[model samples]
Target chain A: MEILNRTKKEGDRTLLDDLAQKELSRRKFLRFSGMAGASALVISGVGLTGCVRDDDGSGTDGVNLGSGDIGILNYAYALEQLEAAFYTQVMATPYSGMNALEGEYLKDIRDHEIAHREFFKAALGTSAIQGLDVDFSSINFSSRDSVLATAKAFEDLGVAAYNGAGKLLVSADYLTLAGKIVSVEARHAALIRDLISNGSFADLASLAPLGANTANALDGALNPPQVLAIASTYVRNRIIANNLPTS
Target chain B: MNVHNLLHEIENVDPEVYDRLDSRRKVMKRFSFIGKTLALAAVPSALGSMFNKAYGQTNDDVKDVLLFAYLLENLEAEFYKGVVGTFAAIGVPAGPAQGALTVIRDHEVAHVAFLKTVLNSLGVTPPVYTAASFDFTGGNGSRMGPFAAAASNYGVMLAVAQTFEDTGVRAYKGQAPRLINNNDVLTAALQIHAVEARHASHIRQMRRNLASGSLVPAGVTLQPWITLAQSGIDTGNAGANAAIQMSYAGEEVVSQATVPITNIGGAVISANEASEAFDEPLTKAQVTAIVDPFVV
Candidate 1:
């Protein structure tokens, strides 16, 4: 129900509104029932009906990440594509005053991002979404500050995305695979942070925006919609992740 | 299969079951209007799943994973405690390096406490381990292993710290699959996992800075991320320390999910980049082997 309202607020009124309408009708049916003990049964029946309804025909007109495990995979593939492209551009036009070591490490990062993108692409095979169109006009590639800031943003976002999506995966193998990739992203985030300002790699005070590293010292985790909203800044494609598993 | 009977059975086992199910009363209020329209045959399975959702999460598998995590956090907390306590003796000046070590020590301590609270909430007693319980030298309390100088040398201390942090990342990853049924715990564990990776990266940066005599080095290949199974630390005598090397084992893998990462889509992704792009998991057994040398 919270997600229903969120999607509605985002102006995605097609499939979500239909589902909400169905739920309203179901509630009306329940209200008209005379038997007192059968409300629980009706509620349970509504749940089953909702699960069945989620099987098909709810995708948006955009790049719809399908349902279930494949949807989760495509979601990851899309993020990797964005990151890979960003790094490829960063390497293609190195920022001014970037020292020799910075250039070398940036190239290494570029290659790593490329490797991650290709791995996801090959792993996804026919199910992979098409290459995304990025709008990097806001980023000043010639300026080291701007490029590093954006890199930090993407790395942190990637870590949060994977952390939030791990539980959505039904297969343990996929969860482990995601786990394997996310740590690398975190490592990248730390390096980028340090390159910007020393010893701020895991600084709890500065991590509030990303939403973790509090008193508990845990990293951030962002759900699909929250992540897509942030990622949509640079990605031109309207990534429709409405069908990703909620639980 | 009556809903009331199920509640009664649960109440018999957990006297405060309704309190645990905070919304049970709201759900019960809806019972008055459902009978005429709903089929009787559809009641039990849905209620069963709902109850399972409410209660079936903290099973033995989740407990095992949590317990393993607890042990690892205890180890890390103890190691950092040693480093922070001996920073002055170890040549760590009272500056950014010392400050960073203190921050890491605090985080590890918080992790230990957090895991303890979670385990206790699940009705399990977390085992206690303190600084006395660990030997940072990998000497099993004898303090004579290859890293014996770790307590006195800043570089050795940073190397040992990097190894533990890297191992922590891998250990958390390996146990994630066992926690799949418990989403909150899984997400929490991943949060901790990423923090450990950050710690590793910072330690690597410290080591690189130390080696190059520059806060930001020039023409140095030592990266925050591990490159192709390289320990990036001096393990002594041509890197003969098997205990330290074991932490990096299987990290050179260029294949994921049976797909070779090199030359993918005709991109010239070197094996080094392929391996660096992803960190591999270490099973509980492998992690135990890596940590046993330091545990008494």
Candidate 2:
């Protein structure tokens, strides 16, 4: 009990002093805590004492998206990587009967996804996770219906992932960035839905598979666990996201 | 000495004591734990300070964000109401186009109600406004502006609707940072924000379809996503009606977080693609400047 109290006090003082003197960003502080290890674990109150298994190059246990803002960023990066890869494949092998406009738009989507993926990777810098290997075996790229259906799924999932992850962000700047990206994702979702069926965009009732609520007319928001569960199907590697901040 | 009695006493001094705490049950559980840990005399002061640390301060930033969201929703709800009312006059066919507009109008109304409920829960009496409070013609209620024909022409109505929906998405994105402290509110705002984006995309699709003379066009110059700040709506002769351009102002950003997005990872991303990759946020002042002309 004495050791616990002392550890808690020291952790609190270190955090408060750093906040007062340096005005450190949450991401910086989280990185600092990651280095501090056990002491920082107490500060987070998760009660775990040991190094969090983040990108340790151990493939057996999967990639553990650490905690706090960085974890969320990595989570987002993983999704973007998946999207970029999928769209790249879509463009490389256009679906049958794809007109000039559809071909142009799909290529545009591929470029946008690449841009988003690169943006997250650069923003995360050294903390960014490795490029995820996706499994697109289920998607029939030659079939328009199959490709459009998959695109709609990924777009909706991306929107929900960002929406669910928004509240978990501690930095206002990061929150705003996520906001900027999520709406674009929503726009993509709408466009894809329209491509499948005209006037079906924003029709939440039909998107029950994605957890959309028709009553509220609000888009669905899936937590990290829920998002990862669906993303795992296409994402070959296991993404351990247990440490993402819930509050 | 009883936890309930202590709460009752605190309630007399501060009527919103319960609201400040998580809940009565949680308070009782926490106080019981504290009762066993500390001496009985230390309970009141300890509880007081605990409450102070927990929920003593009200966040005016969050309130301001909510209020702004409510106002935007009201503006959109009114605009949609007008569109729905004059669908036939505006040449909006009685099929998918009209149906899409109606769905968007309902969503705006729902967002307004949701925000109003949230404000009321926070003890704020949200200002009540209706179609009377807005000018859909962008003439500040004069009803004689560039978009005056918006009520009678399908093309004009779709343009104005597209502008409003796109602006709504940006406006909501701008305020998301303010609501970060309140997780539930942030999530709710995001849900609405995405819906606005969906609305914007559909409106853009509608405009493109109308132009191509088909319910679903094979190819559209105006993609669902904003490309290089192009409004896809007319700016009048020689861009005389440039006030509407403010809605797309600063949307051509090709960089994010100081990272040049156009050329990354050895791949050349076009400036237009980079801009369309991520939607930019508008400040409150910027959004107000764009919307003020239409607001009375």
Candidate 3:
């Protein structure tokens, strides 16, 4: 993960800057309003039901993530679609020096991801969103470094997405299903991390600090906006998550 | 006094009593209907009570659930600490493998400290069990559990490591439903949950890399991703095998919520693939049963 520097096309800050900019601006206005003795009118800018966003770009440009458990399922399904597509490409174009063992493991991961993708598609039934349009042109699949690096990014992102989204589900079954799937993502993340660098399976940057001490923080728990920002770069289809939970 | 007899006498005394009683009964009926509706509508809090007996809380509360999580972190922390403490004796040579154990140990320690902070913030006293409290040997001071021999062997220690990490992953998942309404806590638990999964995966990988020896069980795929019962931990002995199975009883669950996942889209997914794709959660009883031996 790129370190936050408040300006860059790096992964961490892109989406957050857009979303947080709005939130911060709202706070500023309210603070100014409070000074003028209009304090009683302080309204919450974003809510847990979902954040308000204007990124639909006329509906077809991006996917509108719906409300409640269905929206959450759509979110998971979108991720699986991206993963399945990416791995399909990885296998289709093996990286240089990729061994038979790596191929076999990558194929297994690819299949599991496909199964998850189909599971959500079926579970969502008609409620499922359209297949996401993935843009892998930026990826250099022929290079081991780029392929594994991308794999690590996707796996880590998938794990964090599930971690943060698990709570937004109103249905216990959805939460359980998310739990069932997320750990597998975690396993893949570790394997990919090892492939990239052996020892740092759960790297420090992925740990979202609950407090100042690193011990109190959890590894790889990016909220929706932060995850989507990194994910949306590869995803050609716009992903709208207005209905997803905020809190 | 019998209310039935009193009502009967009152009915005989006044002819208009019957009409009055009927009106009162109708009002009571309305109240009962509304009461039933409200009760049915309050499922989340009721879901909260299923954990009450475990934590000694009245009605719905997450404190007991958090305490159970505290116990799990404690269990994992102590297991790793014991292995790190007995590194050379356990045949863990000074290398990356040993360093991996230290990483596992440190993560568990962090988890413990993190959970304790949450518990303290909630105004509930966290459990005071320390690394010294648990006897990971599972031998009540005798140090003779089937896994005891493995504790000293690096390869077998990896097996035990897999067991603890796998159990931790599922235990967090099992307890997640009770904390579903508490998103902050749920998010934190899940954050720890995946880290445990990463640990489990690497530990399995460590075992897979072992030289083909007595320690490596024959005829099993030792791939890092769990594939139901193809797990390399099967030692063929009944007691140890039972322990392994206990940690994995629900891992092969093809059922999601209530229905079969294979039934979705009428997809003909193999049971192995279906089960391997999704990790299952262990119930409180199931998890406790698996971890009880190491508890002391």
Candidate 2 C-alpha lDDT tens digits along B1-296: 46657567555643434443532222233334445645655557756665554434337777889898888999999988888998878888998988999999999888888888889999999888989888877877787766777777787777788888898899989988767657788898899999999999988878776753322223426888988877766635333247767888889999886778897776779999999988988899998988887888
Task: Rank by lDDT, highest first.
Answer: 1, 2, 3
Using all chains and alpha carbons, the TM-scores for the candidates as numbered come to 0.78, 0.80, 0.77
TM-score of chain A of each: 0.75, 0.78, 0.73
Q: What is the alpha-carbon lDDT of model 1 when measured against the actual structure?
A: 0.76
Ten-residue stretch with the least lDDT total in model 2 chain B:
B22-31
- Please, what are the lDDT tens digits per residue for candidate 1 over residues A12-32? 555345344434433443343
After superposing candidate 2 on the true structure, give the runs of residues whose Cα lies further than 4 Å from its correct spot.
A1-59, A208-211, B1-58, B212-220, B237-240
Each prediction's fraction of true contacts recovered: 0.77, 0.73, 0.59
- Of the candidates numbered 1 and 2, which has the greater TM-score value? 2
TM accuracy, model 1: 0.78
Q: Model 1, A169: alpha-carbon shift in Å?
A: 0.6
lDDT of 1 by residue, B1-296 (tens): 45567456545643434433432322323343334445544557756455445434538878999898888898889888887887788888788898899989999999988888899999999777877777777877887866787878777777788889999999999999878767889999999999999999899888887843222223436688877787865545343356777999999998888778877778888888889888999999999988887887
What lDDT is reached at residue A221 by model 2?
A: 89
State the lDDT of candidate 2 residue by residue for A1-247, as single tens digits.
Answer: 1111211325445423322222122223334324435434443542122113334444676665656566788899999999999989998898899988788878888898899899887776545677777899999999999999999999999999999999887666678788888998898899989889988889888665666667667798889998998888897777867767666
DockQ values of all predictions? 0.38, 0.38, 0.25
**TM-score of chain A, predicted model 1, versus the true chain A, to 2 decimals:** 0.75
- Regions of model 1 farther than 4 Å from truth: A1-60, B1-58, B212-220, B237-240
